[model samples]
Target: MMKYMKHLLVILVITIPVLYTVFLFGYHNQTQTTVIYHGINLFRGEEGGDQPLFEKREFTAPLSYVILLTLTFGIVIAAVAGLIWLLFSRWEQRRRLRSEKREERKERLYIEGIEYYFQGDLDMAEKIFEKVKARFPAFISPYIRIADIHYRRRDYRKSLELLDQARVNEAKRVDIFLRKAENFLALDDLGEASAALERAAEIDPKNLTVLEYQRDLYIMREKWEEALEVHKEYVRLVKHRRPEMEEIQNRLQYEIARKLVASEEGKGKAIRALREIIRSEPRFIPAYKVLGEIYVEQNRAEEALKMWEKAYKEHPEHPILLTWIEDVLYEQGAHEPRMSELYRKALEKSPHDRLLKLFYAHYLLRLDRVDEAEALLGELERTGGRLPLFSIFRSEIYERKGRFKDAIKALKAAYGIHSFNEMVFSSGNGLFEHPLHRQRTVSWYTWDRYRINTGQELIPMPDIQRVHRA
Candidate 1:
């Protein structure tokens, strides 16, 4: 009703002025003579006669002029409106096309960047990514690609900076978090990596990728307790949502067992965890290995030997079993008589391994068979490369033969390849005795002090010496 009233009012306003003008012209031009009714004159002129006072009234109305003016003004207004609409439409189309072109160019650059990355041309990839970023400042692909290039080049710090620079809207924040976590993991920054994963979990707690990364980070940090907690969270996350996720379940169970054993402060807990893992996954060699190590650490050499024997029964071609057997026998003070037999058997099993030959040589030297050890070392030298322990053992052999210079040279060679930090090695029986312990202190900040301590101890500075020559 209100709409109709408004329309009616508009129509009255438009027609009133024209209608009044027309009425005025009609009244003046056409005389309204009073018609006599019963000899009475109505609306008469001033004179008594019909045309006495008012001479014959004659006026012209320019109706055609008004009609022509109205049509001309209507055409002009219509033309102006049409021109404005056409200009606006053209501007809008141009703007849309520009946007579409920009999107296409960004996509093309993104593809090119990916290709360059795959080709292992990180420089080219970075260049392409920068171009994409310049062309499409709103695009996320460039940041991701550049970060990946940095990561692949092992410039982890730069990669992390790139990841931090990534822009993520509400819709893409979860993805950004996951990618950031991946970059942190690549850099071995477990704490930050775990935090990123946790953020991703907060966004989408049921995300399996995020959960897996969290678990992996915990494991990398050697935070077995935290790893178990993450495992439980993962279980809760996927509960009933993916009931058929058997692979996830199995992996979670295995990792749980591993973590339980790792965090165990007592031998009882370690043994229990190991037994549970074996029952769950009979073929898990790591479980058996850890159990044997725990036994050995506790001086239960017989039990450790039996565990290795069982492992050997399960896997007949296991070379590490022989290594363990030799270790146990050496610990039992039976290395002299059994050294030759063990070396011969191990060599027969794996003849091409230089490390095996080196170990055999060490045993031979300990047995006072210097000539035999020399022959083995010579054979090892004939091969292409040296084993991790070969140089140290060789140095010991040289020192025994009263060749102090040769002994020092061999020790220098060993130090040059893998710098042995005295603090790290001395604090807790060193790398070889307890390799897993090193995992807990993998941070540069923690290990940096160890290297400083090594420097203080006057440990050989082979790297520094080389730098001086250069």
Candidate 2:
């Protein structure tokens, strides 16, 4: 009813002015009348005052002229109104077009900036992004790109500032919130990162990017349960089942179970969690490892051995599980025959596995079977792709056999092979062209220090002596 009344009001407002104009003109046309007057001519000096004045004449406009005048006035008013409306419409259209062009230009610049960013031209990319931000302050893309550049440069504070500016422009945007969370995480501000992610979750609870970041944050803070929940949600969001996702979730659950096993009250829960993981993902080796450790902690040595044996049967070439199995057997004083049998069977299945061979050879060496270990090491050496560890083992065997000179030669060979591959010195936390050189130098220095401590002859390397002189 109100709508109809408004429409009626609009119609009346427009018609009233036209109707009044027509009515007033029509009334004037009807009421108008012609009038005539006769008077004496005062300026006529010769004529008598009473002499009749010249006949007076008068004229009145025709009714047709009044009607023509009213029609012409209405037409002129209507034409002027139409012309004004047309001009205003054209102006509005031009304004819209200009706005669209401006938006297009901004989008183009943003795309170009992204391309430059991908091309690794950070300077050019930064300048273009800055230009875009300056010209289009409300545009969020450039703000984010610039923030990313700052982040790559490790300028967390500046990155956060740009992200804050973006948030101000678009408070509800999830990407902006995620970027802020990343910046906070980079700065080790876990609490602020969580808060930012929470805000993003409120905006879009099922956003995959938001959930992934939330999971990472939880993991960083060691909030295992929260991370598990987020990972589960992420798996559900994905349409297809992925093996990696299942593995990640199981690993997280395994970690949680491990943490639980640390407490007396939570042991039962931990065991149940571990069992559930094994049941769900039998091939997940870490679950078996953790479960075996839990069983061993509970003094259930037999159960732990059974778990490891089962894992070995399922994954025969798993080096870690094989090592655990050997350790368990040795602890139980039943290692000899069982250890030999396990290695033989595993080698039969995967004879080309060098790491497995190394493990076997090391085990043999531990058992004082030096000849057998040497035989395996010789076979590995003759195979033409010997590892440095092989030479190290050979040196160990040579030392055990009282062949000091041969041992040193083997050690030098190992060092030379290692120099080409090792780029970082583990001792000093530095990189070098030949890490083995640094290692040998450091070892000699350490041995000399020991000799000095013992009042023995110091065997300093040539390089070390030069350094000491310098």
Candidate 3:
């Protein structure tokens, strides 16, 4: 019965304005009749019924009187209605203002709590926020803000507690799920975080924030397949919001493909996955490097070389690829002539690269070009570089060339920079019984910057060089 009364009241309230409009039009039409009635009645009373100013028809029936009575009644009803409407409108405005003031007070308190939080006054902040929650349990903002305070303080447990309370209060709010998930993530609770993200995604799959964080969770867990799917969804959202990330999209695809390869075991399938990465982002250098490494491990040196060469062509200044090329050639120990040519070509492109210069010098030395090796070493020394073993090699070359004094001088300089162990010889030209023991002793003394003293005394160069030549 009450519901029916309420419905009827609503209907009447809606129809009142329409009724008022009809009354206004009806009252306007009655005004002319009332004015004519006043003129006719006055003249009829002043002159006799047959006066020239007053026709019998004008005085007949006093029709304007009825019109005047009707107009008076219409004015009274309109005035009453307008007074009632004005009173009701004022009442309603006051009621709304009161409600707005109450909300404004609550919101101001909530804002004060947030300010306290920002000022690092956690006790005051928590107190004010708790008051808000108690006063307005129906409001989600208090719960959200209080939980955020806990999260900011790294109190994940307390944060979850507040969020749980929020759920108990309003179990259907989407914001609760998101905040809960964020708290779990801050706690490093990936399982809970993933579950929360999944729920949030289910509720509002268009939420790209949830999808992105969930995708990262999947990646951390090494759930590559799930990660790939979620990343695809994220890319779609990104395409809608940011159309300029086309290159980034390709790179994401490449990463997904690479992770797929790493997580799968079948060699054939992994290779195909790697190839997919290359197809998606052809300039992804890591894919090429990994492919080359795989090929090298499989003893397919030629294919490895091809991949490295391609990488070098794409990024010509990449030292790692150049190093790979030199390493591959050195391992194969073939085509010495081509190796030298390649080394020179790479050095010409990057003259200041010390590693390239070292490789080039070694390649020249391997070809028995001692003079070139010595000249290169000299250049490195002039640039204040330190090559510990190069001086020894130069000294050996000098000794082989019969430049004994230059060899000795080079040996002395090498000794000053590095430890030069002297050889011991017997006059009878017999070998030391324990060469290993003597070498170990010499190495230790040399490393300690001490000269090796045989207690027996020092030996001459003639016999030492003779033994060394032997």
Candidate 4:
């Protein structure tokens, strides 16, 4: 009801003025007055003739019609001006809404492009970013994002070109310089990368990301001291230390120590550095391993054994340390009792560890404890152990026991699991069905060739050799 009333009021306002004008026109003629004039000669003959030749008549309108006409004209002029103003206001509103919608579309595209970029779909991200750039030329994010994509593709020149376009503003942005630094670093232009990063640092001195980039640059140039300083700065700025930061610092020290170990004079320095690393991070196994090796090279057998034993006690699952310890003990002719006890104790601690069980079984075999080794191998087989070496060891156990058929079966199983087969066709063709095993045989041959080219050790198959001889 209110809506109808509002519309009706508008119609009334417009119609009232027109109706009043119509009423005034209708009544004006009825109320209008006419005046007539008669003139006589008062001057000479010329004046009398001029006066008689002319008779004057006049009509006068009422005051109401004159006022109505003036008022009607004013109303029409005001209505026209109001209409124009209303139209212009609506047009302006629509233009602003269109601009807002365009901005919204550009923002959505940018967000999608970022998602694709992180998901590793560089091509799709580039296309979307390019569309955004075309549609919204002043939106700087798309230009920078596209440049980053080009940087990832290693198209450094194209990346720089896009970055240049993004840098049209007078003041340089931190992100723009950071991206330039990344591109220069990828191209191995360390000096330019450093310069760009420094400029970024100047713009935002406390930025952790810029500091991280500077640290990486220092590491790349092998300036460990500088890298460490920058890393410390980064930690200070971030206000919280990350575990990886410590690891990176430890690795930097390790490398420095490794380089020092090259000279006899620097061996002492290397040892001191290694000791420092171990003191800081006791669980750092590589430092202990290297330190043990250094002791062995120096003929300090007792020292090497002590260091390795400490490492094994700390991290019992480290197979390399176990193997190294076993080798050293065997070389010293003291492996039988000591190494066996060590393996048994490790197995007790980590009973379900496959690598530990396998190593223990191998150690048992070395000690001529065939029954124990066979029991472990049986457990491995039942539990679906897929390592080819497991099958190979099982075959070895069978051969030692003089179970020729079982030995052959185990060898065939090992062959099936074996990744490389350079000798498969040459020595074991009788074991495999000719046509059925064709693809498997070819795949094995290809793998064998790859292993040989890559200098990987081939899997041992002693039973296959015996079968070939038979």
Candidate 5:
């Protein structure tokens, strides 16, 4: 009803002005008197002189100009409105095309930058992204990409500054928080990392990536109990029972146990936790190692060896148990005979375990029993021990026995062009990677000062000195 009223009011407003102007222009003050027949012949001079020749009738009505004027005015208004609409439509179309082209250029540059990034050209990728960002500052992707370039360049502070400069809602963007957390972690700012992770988790509580980052943050902080909790949530959120996830959870449990062993009163709890972990995963090397160490700390060497022996029964020729055994008993001042008997027993149990045989040979060379190591290496060769490490070991044994020529021959065999980097090795830290270790091992903050008291004496720094194999 109001709509009709507004339209009617507009028509009246337009038509009223047109009707009034037409009335003024069409109206005139003129005499329009009718003549009487008795006085009509005064001005007659023709054959019809008696006729009232000039009698003028009074105006009955003025022509109706209101409708005509109103129509003309309406047509004029419509033509002007249509012209304005046509021009506006063209202008809007051109503007839209320009905007689309601008967006396309931005997209093209972004794709080009991404391609360079994938091709491992960080400098070119960064330059292209800088151009994109300068021209299209509102684009979030360019900012992220540029920050990533800084991160890859190890300019963590610059990456963080760019993230801070992003004109976006930080709390609402889980990815931003995640990247910020990564930068903070790179800088070893655990507190800032934790805060970013917490904010990310708040934004996306069930996100697996967020939980993983949270778990990592806690692990870096050495808050094993908290890390364990976060890991549990990650496990719960995961849809599949992946071996990797199970392995990670087991490591978290081990770390928690390790932490508990830090305090005098927490030893028993730590011990129980370690035992529980071992029971759940008998082959988990770190739990066995740590538990054995703890038992040795409590003057329980017999028990430590007994526990390892139990696990060795399940995986008879496993290198981790043997190596841990070697380390522990060496600290116990293991003699040539004692260590030999240990290997001999293991070799007898797994006669065909080539890796085991290689390990034994390596151990012999370490003991400077060159003849025994050579005999074992010869046996390995006879059995087609094709492992590249076999050649490395062969070279070591040959060098030990004053066969420099043969040592060089063996060394050459290990580093063919394609196989130069094939024999790389990294030790496991139990069921997971050792916490907070990369580019360094056992950082000072996590390293136990009194490791000697816990039956973990320092082996020499050159425990596995390189012969320049790689």
Candidate 6:
């Protein structure tokens, strides 16, 4: 386009000057010429001179006719130039259209590759894309397609080689960089993967896919600090926030806080970040547990108890909170008053809550409040059927009251266990234990799901504080 503009400018530069000169020199009127010629002739006639050369002026026309003739000449020249330019433009446009049509025809084979790819005929797709690659070398789609086929076939090195070729053909292709990064990640080449992602980010900084990939890469490398930063940007750029995204952000934030807590210098910042997470995500039970531990590690028992109590009061189903609270108070023999009042208040709020009532029963039995514990057990059995933990809790009551034989009878009858062993109980360690590691010990928390990590897949907590507040 700039070339065409320069040519037009040159034509204008030459034509305007010539047209201006003609208008300046050829602007003569016939009246002025006639007066001069007649005056000169009259003088000659008076002097008896026969000068036939002074008859008229042939070069000058009338004023209006001169203007008309000049306009006509300009119109003729302009028409000729305009026609030539129009013809040239049409020819160039046709040439471009033909080239585009040829490219489209080459892509027709690419369409067959796509059809075969979706049909799961990878071998044919590979062949078709290879042919397309040879014919349409400038375009990166065929290379991308072939690389994808290799990736599906688990030929990661081959996939990467094709992607490298694509990158050479089109260095600015973000998809090429993304695919190369993926292939590198699959091959466990973090250095190459990082380089690819860095290039992609430089090309398009705000790309959501690039941000997600970076976030995952950092997380896989256990670079919690970097992962947190990338995840924050990802969350900010997301148009619609999803529950899974919230969960991911929570995990990243918690991982960072955990790392901070691990370092002596970062404990205070970790505490602050954990508190922020707890405020925004009250249902996230791990944040509460970790924050409590941090306080306990510093010998800040009072603060830890207060924090755990605050959380337990809001979410009674999370047995971990109850465990943390009672374990602190039980050793000192001061759990009665605090735990009693807390359970009373929780029962008042959720009176129909069987889990809370059952937890209170377990606490009572552990304290040797056999009568109250028995009453709750009977109510639980009558209203909500019996759980294995219920039988275990009853045995706990009998054991607390010095009825060892009946405790053994109750456990054996409920679980049909043939083994015999001592059940060591501790408020801090566990509620019940098998004698020689032959059976799984029952924990004081008596959590629902067994055989998993502590505090995992516990009951879903209440929604006093929802997610995404921050």
Selected candidate, larger TM-score, 2 vs 5: 2
State the lDDT of candidate 6 residue by residue for 1-470, as single tens digits. 56766766787777767666655654543332211233235555555655763566346454544554666688678868876887899899999999999878887888888999889999998899888888878878888888888887879999999988988988987888888887787777888888998999999999988887777777667787797788789889889987767666766677788888878899998999888888777877778878888997899978999988878778766655776687778865788788888878878877897766777787776776789889988998899787666776777777777788887877876566765453443321354433423332211111122212221363321221111100
**Candidate ranking (lDDT, best to worst):** 6, 2, 4, 5, 3, 1
Consecutive 10-residue window with the lowest summed lDDT within model 2? 461-470
Give the per-residue lDDT of model 3 (tens digit) for 81-177: 7667767877998999999999999999998998888788988998999999899888877777778777778898998888888888777666677
Residue 94 lDDT, candidate 3, scale 0-100: 95
**lDDT (10s digit) by residue, model 5, range 277-340:** 7777676666787889888899998788877776887877355567666666767886457667
For model 6, give the RMSD to the true fold: 12.8
lDDT against the true structure, per candidate, is 0.60, 0.72, 0.61, 0.70, 0.69, 0.72
Total backbone collisions for each predicted model: 0, 0, 0, 0, 0, 1
lDDT by residue for model 1 (1-470), tens: 35544755675577657766765675556634332223334557566564343334433435544444565577568657766766787799899999899778778878888888888888888998998877776677677678777766778778667766775423346666776766675666667777877778888887766666666566556555675677677777664655324333333444455455555475576577677766666554556666777777778878977777667556644444556676667768875566566567667767886656665676666667788888888777767557535666677677678787776667667656343342222111221232322343322112121222111111111110010000
**Model 1 per-residue lDDT at 37:** 24
Error of 2 at 252 (Å): 0.9
Q: Write the per-residue lDDT of candidate 4 for residues 228-273, one digit (tens) a residue.
A: 7887788777877767677667766776777788888888988998
Clashing pairs in 6: 431-444
lDDT of 2 by residue, 252-296 (tens): 787798789889898899999989989988866667777887888
TM-score of each: 0.54, 0.67, 0.56, 0.54, 0.56, 0.59
Judge candidate 4 at residue 51 and give its lDDT: 57
- Poorly placed runs, candidate 3 (over 4 Å): 1-69, 119-123, 168-175, 239-276, 279-283, 294-300, 326-347, 351-470
If both were scored by TM-score, which would come out higher, candidate 4 or candidate 5?
5
The 10-residue segment with the lowest total lDDT in model 6: 461-470
